[model samples]
Target: MTQTQNTTHGGPDALGVPAWDFSSNANACGPCPTALAAVQQADASLYPDPTYAALREAIAAFHAVDAGRIVLAGSASEFIGRVSAWTAREGGRRAWWPAQAYGDYAQAAQAWRLERTDDPAQADLAWLCEPASPLGGAEQQAHQVVGSALQVVLDRAYEPLRLRGVCSLDPVAQNHVWQLWTPNKALGLTGVRGAYAIAPEHALTEARALEQLAPSWPLGAHAVAMLDAWLSSAAQDWLTHSLPTLREWKRELCAMLEDLGWTVTPSDANFFCATPPHRLNAMALRSHGVKLRDATSLGLPGQFRLSAQAPEAQVALRRALIAQKERVA
Candidate 1:
């Protein structure tokens, strides 16, 4: 009896071409039985109340800020969407967009008819990213934040720098800025849709009133369970301890790609950007079963944003990309 194996990962890997999808900002969370059970047990309960209460404490404590500063939401995207609406209602001023930032920032500004301006002091809002999501390098990063003119809406998706660092919550910008954080991106909870906003405590005054006029809110009992489990010292230790292995894997990714002749932007964050040799564009990379964000969208000099996935996955990607190099030559 040829028993069929239950394959859990549903991707092009099933095909001969290895799949390297580095489009997301999330760790490949371990689906431990205990954590999975927390989600399963929530099958018959309402989550918003319990989840929010627990997460409120957990997240705020993590950031070392007051819980009131947080606006737990479906995702960082939601926080941005609502905040843009608030900016509009308060009279959308000229929008400050990074020379290169998350695509949604442009969409958010347009939805509210915000004018674009690179000058920060004269700007009404600044929508930006940190570790500069699409592209990353020490010098490029320093240039991005070297001397800001106005309020900073730091997209600290990579802030904790892998669990051990002091979960820096944009301290410099905390005085008069709005930042986005998503546990989904940070804690391998991508599938959970857990995100929170860290604004100055006073921004809460303006935000709380606005939140009332906002739509209904709820935290899935399941999501809460995951958050609860994640808050425990045990879970924290697990994540905090995994940094070395994670860092090693990331370094391996950069070294391997470099050895294969790819120009990877230096990044300590979970991902990095790469400029393929002139002969190859993003589609060519995708053809090898890796779906990278096209750098062309950022109007940058590259055409790919690669990530470091599981070690096995990285090995597969390295081989595929190397094969592509040979094919082009």
Candidate 2:
């Protein structure tokens, strides 16, 4: 939505395949070889010690925070779950708000015995999908939550805009415990299953309690290295270039969907949510080999999520949807 055109990543340039909206995180700019090399050089003998220490420092430095405030996690979900669990036990109630966004938040509330309410005033914690998970509400609602520069677990899974200005937190301070960045949707890093959490001291302390209770959640040697490489200078530069390309691709996909006369949400990030124009059922789409998600598992409905990361996947989705329109017509 920010950039106007998508000239760089058209057909085969960004992906070897011919699709644009795939589930794999191919839309991301990070996770290239520039980062993979770091994985190889990682001192495996020291195991979690060196990797965790190095990761803590890198994350803290990247987010501009004191090293002591940083907490590490193998995955962002682990960090969030720990926090939610702690809140339930300590706060004696679920920090749940009656809002419709990411389902994980509600699940956390339910797990911790939090109640959902329509009134924002009654809410103590808000689990926002920062740039949002393709539903497109986080931007407007964020200011209210981060009243005086609020804290966030920014999931820059597909940062359309460089986090500098867009993030609600002290972008320079790295105050929030940002969740994991994987290649599944963008760089094909899903198989590797590596993720990181960047958090302030208190949040880290709370989340770390879960780790002490369950040490198995720590990241493996290579996965942590993969994240480290992306944080490296050369990799960052690559991201600078790759992000816009993804932006362009996303824009193009939305336009094409609109042109087809199907009611599609205008998406700024890599994906959009839509029910077929005729109010088509998503279950049928899955049966046709299109295989769209119902958003219910992730907490959305009549809407499907697409990965704008891979050009081939998007193109494939476009074709599939276009064909579906004809069949329904």
Candidate 3:
């Protein structure tokens, strides 16, 4: 797909929202009550601290890192753009990312005129999203690219929602790369649009550069509130409690799709990609208020990425798929 078309994200748009959305990978058991309450109670009347000192401190404490190493972002997309810009500013000529991964990485690279490289070592910058989107599988190349001269940024957006498997990188290895986290996904509050990157330990220079590139007041009050709640023990406990429910739902959904002859790919996160035995008319399903992310944009043609959702939503999806099949028949 062309860059313009490939960059399309799965969320409410001109077609309106889906009744059973399995497009975006937000936690099925969320918006967590604690985080939701915090967002609702956010004082939007006043601007957040420009320095984001308190917010940074809170996030830093949660990760047990120095506040100075925390680089704030308006959102994951914003950070992608800012980092791409930083790469460009530093005379980076090329960028590398997974062949099938988030489209924004490519979009940002395109905007900055950075040539795409398939080999990590050949690129000035590289992007890695663990339990990556579309397939939701562990990144096979993660360990290989480490210790290279490549400026690697690990997108840990799905880490909180990971249902199984251990991360490929140990603490020492993780400390060598930029670790980006978007709490909104874990909190099931994507609308809040706040993210932060824990700069590699001892990489204060690069961290300072990223901070300088970001816009002032990168996070608004609501985003700050959601993120603040994200670091709380109550919120963590809520997320912990939701995982078992998600695991069970995932198992049921996978079984249902497999029984229907869909090729469900194994995944460690809350989402997975599958290709049906027959071609599926996605728009037809969307008409019935059921939506699945067309993975063609994420470089997986003839497949769709589905997020684990409540059983009722799964039932709605199954009904819609059957209806579509009937219509085609």
Candidate 4:
């Protein structure tokens, strides 16, 4: 049975594509030309190396870590589930994550029947993300937990797309937690579905165990190509260049929402949550060819999470909201 049938996400929905989609935090300026070319040229007919030897080495070099620390996954969500399952298998009873975080963290814990706890000190496993999802803010108590013996997974999916602010964790602290990297969002290639985790410096044994849980060839050829391209100078440069445009668009988005009487939440990343002057009817907006991510599933009800978009799309969203209000009036 599929657990995701009820899972809430912000991209294209059952109604098809939205004219203006702000449901996801993907880089609005991409699909990166370099990464796209690599995916297009991927050798789909041939199987990727069962061990992914060269790919793992490249990723290790990119992060300047030992190859043994690189644990490949089909995607970020897949890794979340894998690690949660690993914790459960190893006799872990409790898991902790930020009050508001990507739903998969909770979903995986639930699937593995791990009890949820509010206190990280009491938890056998913990999850943290920064420039966090929905809020696009820092993870509370990150520094303390990162260095502790508690098994921690630090989702760095949005770090590359950070428009403002610096990571609170220093390099030394970062080496103590499992650093999960999903470059698809930064490259604006979310559809590619590739991700990896740099295990803590002393977690080689844990990393090997997690690898055992994975199926052979967990990442397909397209995913391999996408990740391989993700490490290239061209793709990295393109991603770096996209951030300023995203930052400008984020400013415009926040300004536009504020002008419309929405209460915008401050964030350091490319997205933020805003509460409309009145209750938001997401379906009504969807009918108007606009799709916004309702933060209800992300534990922030009555608010919407919007990723930065180009000016034209922003204008379209502005128009739609105004039109909706006028029709109601």
lDDT by residue (tens digit), candidate 2, 1-329:
11111111222222243323243335454456666566667776765663377777887687576665555555555656666665566563525332445555677778777676544445555555545664542456554544522233446555533322355545433344334444323443544556555554456565455446445537777777776766677766776677777677667666766776656765555556665556544334433434443454445545555545546655666667777777877
lDDT of 4 by residue, 33-113 (tens): 999999999999999999999999999999899999999999999999999999999999999998899989999999999
Ranking of all predicted structures according to lDDT, beginning with the best and ending with the worst: 4, 3, 1, 2
Model 1 has an lDDT value of: 0.61
Name the regions of candidate 4 deviating beyond 4 angstroms. Answer: 1-7, 147-149
TM-score: model 2 vs. ground truth = 0.75
Alpha-carbon local distance difference test for all models: 0.61, 0.53, 0.89, 0.90
Could you tell me the C-alpha RMSD of candidate 3 in Å? 2.1
Give me the runs in candidate 1 sitting further than 4 Å from their true place.
1-18, 29-37, 44-47, 137-151, 162-175, 281-288
Per-residue lDDT tens digits of candidate 1, residues 1-43? 1101111121223333335566555664444344566767776
Error of 2 at 284 (Å): 5.6
User: Residues 1-329, candidate 3, lDDT per residue (tens digit)?
Assistant: 33223225676756777788888899878889999999999999999989998989999999999898899999999999999999999999999999999989999999999999878888888998888887888889988777564789999999998999978988999999999999888888888899999998988888998999888888999999998999999999999999999999999999999988899999999999999989887777777888888888789888888989999999999998888778888
| Model 3 score (lDDT) | 0.89
Tell me each candidate's TM-score.
Answer: 0.80, 0.75, 0.96, 0.97
Clashes of each: 2, 29, 0, 0
Model 3 vs. true fold: TM:
0.96
After aligning candidate 3 to the native by TM-score, how far in Å is the CA of 97 from where it should be?
Answer: 0.2
